[model samples]
Target: MKMKIQFIVLPLITLLFIASSIAYAQNKNSAADNRNAIDRMTKELGLNETQRGKVEGILSAEQKKVEAVFNEERKKLQLIQEETRSNLQAVLTPEQMQKLENKMRQEGSKNNAQKK
Candidate 1:
């Protein structure tokens, strides 16, 4: 019984986690990617110190904006997920919910490992 519930919920949670992360998961590489782009642009364009500073500022601002948008979206997603979980709590048995939660934790760890 437990294994059945866990198997089902594990995959569903994994899919949801992927879907949620899709909206704003690039921040981990954003800084490195942006820095590389800036470096390439600077070298190709031969930007002076003043121009470089302006360009860096522009890039930083853009990155910040992107981060902000994603953060906001993630928050909204989190709220929706919480509501869904709460609603499920009404339908699922406590034992089933415990198994589901454990499965989710195991999946979360697996996801984190892949990210690293």
Candidate 2:
């Protein structure tokens, strides 16, 4: 029936969207972490005082740029999530919504565990 098809297709689309978003977030976080590591390593490595000062300045500027990009990306992601939630709400019943929420929570927990 049309309702059954809608039920199946909607959840599949939602799950795929969520999975892709999470993967994108993970990639962004990984890039930030790598940048942080590089900055730390650069600081720890011995250099002339002038060179160290220059490196520090460069790192500070890079951090600000990265933070700006991150904030923009986060805003975009939030908008996408809100739009997806609204669309999914139209297609999903309360019970289905709960299931989707639980699935997201479980995925989050798994990601956290993997990070640890």
Model 2 CA RMSD to the hidden true structure, in angstroms = 5.0
- Count the clashes in each prediction: 0, 0
lDDT per residue as tens, model 1, 1-116: 64565566557667777667666568777999888988998899998889888999999999999999888878877887787678668768898788778878787778778877
Best by lDDT: 1
Worst 10 residues of 1 by lDDT: 1-10
lDDT string for model 2 (35-94, tens) is 676567666885666766686677667766866776677677677778877877887788
Model 2 global lDDT (CA atoms, 0 to 1): 0.66
Model 2 pairs in collision: none
